[model samples]
Target: MPDRRDLDIGELMTAFDAVVRANASLMTQLSSRAGVHDTALRALVLVSDTGYSTPTEVAGFLGLTSG
Candidate 1:
């Protein structure tokens, strides 16, 4: 483990920025190619929470479908 006291705020901020940038790049790829997969994943989460719902509900939550 690293020493928490040794962590500089500037270094932590830089690391956070790098992580956000990496995630943006990854989301761009998913949006460009497997966008529907992203919608499906969100729908899965909603179904898991509410037990069951129509495809329209899932799509609506993901901003892809309407009832």
Candidate 2:
């Protein structure tokens, strides 16, 4: 049988509120360790997903600059 504690964690992780909270907590921890602003991590994630993006494009999409 699946461990009850593991099942509880899985259910909690699947919850939208739990997922968002967990993501925010992890991002905070990661940004602190990486020595970069949280927005920088967000921008990196956005840039990595789009192969054809440029700096201007990314800035515009990220609202860091006027499009």
Candidate 3:
């Protein structure tokens, strides 16, 4: 196990935030490259979260109609 004394919560949180921002930036780039709209990318993320979602389910999650 690692030593607790070596841990800095603030620094760890900053690093985590940086990683999150970087990942978001990368996802935006990928979405743009794939010619996907922001809403479509968000729906894809929702579908991934649900593990097996239909268009209706995704639409509902996004407060949209599946029509």
Residue lDDT tens for model 3, 1-67: 6577556776798899999899879878989998998678878888788788986788887789745
* lDDT tens digits, residue span 1-67, model 1: 6677556766889899999899767666775686566555556668999999987777777788444
Cα RMSD to the true fold for all candidates: 7.3, 7.1, 6.2
In candidate 1, stretches whose alpha carbon ends up further than 4 angstroms from where it belongs are 1-7, 36-67
lDDT of 3: 0.82
TM-score attained by model 1: 0.43
What TM-score would candidate 3 get against the native?
0.57
**Candidate scoring better on TM-score of 1 and 3:** 3
Q: lDDT tens string, model 2, 1-59?
A: 99999999888768978778898898888988999987788678777887577888778
Best-to-worst order by TM-score is 3, 2, 1
TM-score winner, 1 or 2: 2
- Pairs in steric clash, model 2: none
> Which residue pairs come into collision in candidate 3?
none
